[model samples]
Target: MDYIQMRQKRFLIAAWAFMECLLFGGLLYGWGSLMYVFKHEGIYAELCNNNDQAALSAMTNSSSSVTDVTLTNSSEETKLSDSNFKGCPEQDSKFTLCFTIASALVCASSAVLGQINFMFGTRVTRLISMIIFVGGSLMLAFVSKEIPWLIFPGLSLLAAGGLPLLVTNTQVSNLFGKGSSSIVGLLCGGFDMSSAVQMVVKIAYESGISRQHSYYFLTALHSLVLVSTFIFLPKDFILNEEAMSTNIEVAGDVNVTTELPIELKERGDVVNEKTGGLKENNYEKKELPTLMSCVRQPLYIMHVFWLCILQLRFYYIIGTLNPYLNRVLNKDDKMVSHFTNICFYIMMGGLMSSFLTGVVYDWQKRCFASSRSSLRQNLMPAVLPLTIVSFLAVLLSALVLVPVQSLLYLIFIILTLFRSFLYSMAAAFLSAMFPSEYFGLLYGIMILCGGVFGFVQFALFTWAETYVEAPRHTDIFLLCLVLVSFLHPLYQWYRCSRAEKELTQ
Candidate 1:
């Protein structure tokens, strides 16, 4: 690819990343704040045509009667408050379930969309996702209790609209070669910073902006994404010849070839015999591994398992934070909002970590080349250190939960930053190990596993909260869970180190 094309690809990647950031902000992180509005703002009352008042009153009476009976029987004090009854009956549970189910649907659909991208190319896939997202937002904005089922479809479509996230990472890795790590970091950082988007929306809502206006704002943001996708994304989804050639290097007098799929070879792009470089069409052809073949690889399985574990904890933390703050820590609404606003700043730590990881990764590659050593042998130097830091951070975060209420803000900051750092490191690892053609499919599968594990994690936490009764005691069990989860990465690191030693000997 020429300079102009390279610049264009970079610009498109940035646009896509920004689009994903907005989508995530409005749909993923924004849901919690939206639910708060539904509860406190009379939005649900309007949706239910003011019938919610009668229902909430009846529920409150029933709750008081139950509390009276319990107190009389056990000789203990029980308190009930009007504030607790502020929201529509079951709104919290309804919204939480909607968010969880929507996330799973997004993962499953993204997996399918990955295959579609391979078949139809970037433009079609992006257009489909954009339409779904916009349509879903409109549905959400106008939905009422009469059409309660709309919540499922609306949230699901909005979540699925994140297909560009999968595509952009693959494209950046393909265009930038070894230097893609920092760029990928920037992309993922944009994603993590989506909490800021939600914060902005939340601020707007709290400052007397109507819910309908908030929905309109979201729709406008997604419209920008649609326009950017149409204008910036390339028509032909071909890998850059220069980036591909740079990826092919000589180490220890042996050529390291990054294979493309057989389909690209048939497109008239050919390798030059004399220069050992790609010629014609400014594209490089490489043979890619099929999805089935990828599933059969043990290391691939290990990588997916590690990712699932990471996400299990991540989703659980994010999902439970509001209740944990309000119920367990006794934080007020303003405090909760304040903490949420700071989340993106904490996530910025992950952005820095990811960029540093990329710089180190590229530097290691240069070192291998200069020393005439095998690049393949050093393909994953970043994994070990990243895993160690991630494991320690998780351990500390879990331990701090015992005193979490005392230092709630600090603990969350540390936890969010390190968890995000781990996520970026994992993405970089996959990009380095796999062919770009298969990255999307494989990433989708990883996300699918995460969704499955996340649901299981959510169920476990719900069970604990319902059956255990003591939040402090539950922290002990959660700590144990975090510890057990580390075993997967530790075992994988051991296996990889052993393999590297064997290769050296």
Candidate 2:
């Protein structure tokens, strides 16, 4: 790609990243604000009360006091009869149900989107995701109390919009080559900045905008994103036969004989001996590894396992951050807002970490290239250090939770910053390790596994809360989980170092 084309690709990556930010903001993080609107406007209460009345009417004794429900304007607090005031539990349950269903759908949609990307291509998958996102936002805006169930499907569509983010990451990796970690980091930074979207929505709500209007605004924004994606993203950027052929040659040549472990040379396994140069005829009959074959690799399995665990912990922490802060600080509204602002700053920290990590990744890659070293030499310098630092940060953050609340908060922020950087770095590393054609499928599988683990952990947490007194310390449990998650990276590092030592001998 020339200068203009490279610039265009970068611009396209930025646009896609922005679109991903919007999808996360409007669908995932925006839920809490939207649910607050439903409660404040008496919509959720009314829905619960209707269900109660229907249940009562079905029984022979229908003597429950009827509670009057009315919609309150944006400026007024919603009021219900005393009999209905206790319906908060039921309303909360209903909201949880919708949220859970939407989350499950998002996971399912991610898997489906991966298949679509593999079978059809990135263009079709992204266009479909964009349309679904807009449609979902419109549904949320127009849904009435008569069909409260519409919220479930609307949220599902919104969640599906997130799938295109993975597609864009793959595209960036493919276009710039696997070593373009800085660019991927820039894109991931845009993703971390999604918290700004939530902040904007919260401000709008505080300014007295109704939920419907907020959703309408999101719909319009997504529509613009859709059009921009269609115009800017190249249709031929996805992996094709030609691209795969070229990449095969590149992958074949990365293993310089000098860098191979001596044991490998003794076994006559080095590539430079027999295949000195990449020729078209050499790969003409070679078949790319299938997705199943990749999955069966021990290293890949370890990667997926640790990635899922990290994602599960991160998702849980993010989902419960507000409640966790409230429990820790016992703050009033103004103070709570201040703490939330601090969280936003932490997000900015994450953004910077991502960008910096990317720059370092590219730098390390350049160093390896200059030294005529193998890509394996770049792994420890470019990726393993970040993983180790992030894991330690998480462990320390959990350990410090028993100290002063303010101190704990600071440590947590540091943890979040590095954790965010680690996520992007891992994604980029995996993208480089795998072939472009199977990247979507593998990435989607990782996401699906993460979602499943998150759901399982959530269910376990709920069970503990419901059935146990003095339940296990969640922080301690998370710390242990983080510790266990580091084992895979340690294993990889050990193998790499051991191989390098043998090669040097």
Candidate 3:
């Protein structure tokens, strides 16, 4: 195969990975739509019905006549009608808890999964994720009111399993050379769009399709991933240009031989005189930077802090989205459903947002591209993307405070862009600043910290439950916290400017 063939193969692999991510990466985050279906399916409706029954019993005891008791019972039953039923606090809390646990797992497992990828290679990591995802989908498909608790584990596994797809896909950017950042952004965008799957599922459910069947359909789609894993993706990791040069077998022609150092040949590395150094497993043997060293870096610390505040804010907003919409829309279920669908639909725009951001980063990188510059200096352009993300986050928080029904459209639009930037830029920046060898580990740490911060969302949801205006106050608090994120960008900008000045001198 020639250059064109190799490039085409790489592009095709990247495109396929993008499709896989868009379809399955982060469906758990689409909680609003999925929760809507869950509520309609009466996953925890018994709790609400029992509360309704208790209310009925109390009313009967307080009534002086059978007619009054009958009227009260009729009204209660009518309100409990599944068509227009608004869930009780207890039921909503259970859903919130499920999201909290699942989302936490999504973030928390990043490092361990990254480690698995680092140690066991892409094939093993993807296989593990595939099995977990299939099992989770099956579990969710069979979930009923009789076993409502299954949602906890099912959702957890689903989220944890899907994340590796995103992690593995981001590395595909390595194939694109200068356009690598853009590729990373596009892939993250696909992950963002995965949230729309739940939106589709909810729409299907409203159109007479069952949640079980919808999941079964999704489970069937997993075959595409299984096929891609074995056929397209590298068994270990994608080799960079230097590594690629060392392995002549990569181009499907083993006639060429590249001599290896004596040290390597003595270490049981197979150096064929006819076929060159076919050391496919040698990529895994390369030493990566220590995890602690990466963690202790000021840049990593600031990035984690930057990601955590935004992640917590985003998670809280998603976890309480239904209640917040209900409160704003005066519990109009129809309007709430309409807006929820619109919100998720807009989330699909994350792909465009990420692509544009990646373009911006790549363009800026071209401007700053210098053969003499240090890696740190070359990465200075990333500060602009980071700053843009911070500004968007602040704007999103401010918009959340307005509570106008009509503004939700604009809010969702901004939300999609902001979220796309959040994850995409985080990955892009880390990959640009750190060694590719450490990218997985560092990226996982960033995600793990952010995921841990996500737990705070439960507390905020509790506040919203306890106080009618708590969401408003929470928005205000988030706005303030997001303002702090500006510090990371500002500091980076200063560093970039300083580095430029030194370079000029």
Candidate with the greatest lDDT versus the true structure: 3
For candidate 1, write residues 1-505 as lDDT tens digits: 4435756577666656655653553246445555555555433333342444454455455533322212235744332232233343244445667777876777787778777777787778878887887887778777654565677787778777754554543465556656777666666656665655555666776687765677677778766665545565555353544435444554454443435332232233456543445566665433345777666666567777776666666665665555565564443555666665555446545555555656765665565443222323344365554565457556654755554555765765666555556656667766665656566677778777777776775465555456435445555555666666565556655654564565568
lDDT of 1 at 457: 53
Listed in order, each prediction's TM-score against the native is 0.77, 0.76, 0.85
Clashing pairs in 1: 259-286, 260-286, 260-287, 260-288, 261-286, 261-288
Question: For model 3, how does the per-residue alpha-carbon lDDT over 352-413 read when each residue is reduced to its tens digit?
Answer: 99898899999888777762334334556787898889898889899888889989999999
Taken over the whole model, the C-alpha lDDT of each candidate is 0.58, 0.58, 0.79
Better of 1 and 3 by TM-score: 3
10 residues in a row with least lDDT, candidate 1: 63-72
Please identify which of the two predictions, 2 or 3, would achieve the higher lDDT against the true structure: 3
Candidate 3 local accuracy as lDDT? 0.79
- Candidate 3 Cα errors over 4 Å, as ranges: 1-6, 49-79, 242-288, 370-376, 503-505
By TM-score, who's the top model here? 3
